[model samples]
Target: MRSKRIVILTEGHTNPITAKTAWAVLRYRGGDVVALFDTTQAGKTAGELMNVGGDIPIIGSLDEVAEPDALLIGIAPMGGKLPTEWKSIIVSAIERGMTIISGLHDFLSNDKDLVAAAEQHGVELVDIRKNNERDVSNRLDLREDCLRIHTVGHDCSIGKMVTSVELTNELKRQGQDAKFVATGQTGIMIEGDGCPVDCVVSDFVNGSIEKQILANQHHDILVIEGQASLAHPRYSAVTAGLLHGCLPHGMILVFEAGRKTVSGMPHIPLTPLPKLIQAYENLAALHMPSKVIGLAMNGRLLTPEQAEDERKRVQDETGLVVCDVFRDGSEPLAAAVMNLRAEIFGTPVAS
Candidate 1:
């Protein structure tokens, strides 16, 4: 019988640890492991492949690697910090229509171009961050958690607070093992002191940084909260690519008063401005595909004029399917995002 093949896209050294680990795991699970590298100076590369021995095959680049059941990406302990080194291997794999699992840490910085390249090729980006969710001390409060958890910059909001919390709880309940960390006003919780967890969270701080950590570490899922959509559209898409291993199913735009919505690209909603002025160049505002639809949620308080203008701005900028929340019913923002994906891809929304 043919062995199930799994490809590991990584630099030279650190791959051995993973290569051997994967070989053992796959064998136990009834599969195989394959290693591919463009170049490796670090002694780690040879050691790992050798450690895994004959079972795991080592290849040169994405082009040389055969199709596998899945692709696993990681940073080589001895690998250079730059993500670009692994670009050819990553892009080539995705272009060939292979399933991918990536390390978020290096992926965001080193493989950024490859990330974009992967999306263009319609490859699904999977986050290994959840594997580390348990790494977070449950005893540690949110504030200290944020300190330990590195963040990028701070600008933008994550969206509705109630919705964000609920989603966090749901992820936990589902045993998806994702970490729900925050920034901005609602940033991580510290001690018994009170902090504005409701302020528009910053994606630069939490979402990007956390996702990278989760991916680099190879965790399954990592949930970054307080990131507002439209704030940093590219980073948002990048985050989506890092975490979910694909472009965000779609983007969400929300309006809620006194709520201080966190905004970024992808899942995060933008700031709550009365008039969300939008214009379009050749590309979508957030580098989203033309196929993604834009939707509006009234938050049940917008005037007719306000709603009309919001609708117009979204329609003009995205050229996507737009739906009014008031008309669409009060589905939670996360659920709404799933619904939009279903409508576009013709797949049933995973309830």
Candidate 2:
């Protein structure tokens, strides 16, 4: 999948928040992304819109791109439903012999028109969110030698996946045997394989994530991507399941610096960072002892000064290393994880 020449369809929504799939793929797998299809933002490079995806052109239509191997749905909205207006674009891509890839909860395989069109064109429709695993959690013991680091969030879509990926990459850069265990659609896409834990049945959520952890336990470190916040009104169940499933040794708390309300739910105010930190720690303590080792701030909405100030405030209040992994790089957060690992397991940090 990483080798395929892919064009992302972001259409009208092409910002970092809305078009996170496009942004993340470009950030981690830019070589595979040939172009992005966003008519509203056509004629501009993705780098021009977001700070990532250097020089990748944004095309208005499929005809503007030449011989792409796949078309990825690049936006993940609240309900994860496919926009009605994008059907024609997807059909057109299928007609042109490009495989369709989606992460929406509304499965493309269930759509009659898409299925018929794909059959006619002899192209595949890959739904990253589709899961068939029926395994239930058995409280299986995990590998003692491997260190599991999980990312927990204050609200949904606050950069847990980004923080996990960046930390894993940084650990690898430092010569540690680290593996990223992806738990969501974006992370799965970036890693090429992972269970969309959020999509699995409630009974199988823990088992689903445990399967991935066990599979990757050969590595010395497992940086697991997280899902919705435990404080989230609608999606907290998945968070609790993940917390119990992975049983992380340490966690990095992620939050958008100035975000006060739950995303897409303005009426529900976001839980404070300290309370969220406590809640996650308390929840994890039920199954295994785990601590919040650090904080990863999503400061995209804040200016440089404001971001820095918030980082300091968070650090001062929480007494943990705080970093915006994208802006400050993952070295500090990685170092914190390594320190925690060394403290808990007496593991030697690589020079």
lDDT of 1 by residue, 1-351 (tens): 122466655555333333332332332332355544425532233334544334344555555555565566534222213355565665666777676664343333234775686678776665332122212212212221111111111223212332333444554565534344432222221111112221113333223443334333342333333233333544454333222221233333444422343422335544323233232111232543422223333333466677666666756655544345444432343344445435554664344
Candidate 2, position 92, lDDT: 93
Question: Candidate 2, residues 83-127: lDDT per residue as tens digits?
Answer: 999999999999999989999999999999999999999999999
- TM-score of each candidate structure, all chains considered together: 0.31, 0.97
Query: lDDT values of the candidates?
Result: 0.38, 0.91
Compared with the true structure, the alpha-carbon lDDT of candidate 2 equals: 0.91
In candidate 2 the C-alpha lDDT for residue 234 amounts to 95
Error of 1 at 206 (Å): 17
* 245 Cα displacement, candidate 2 (Å): 0.6
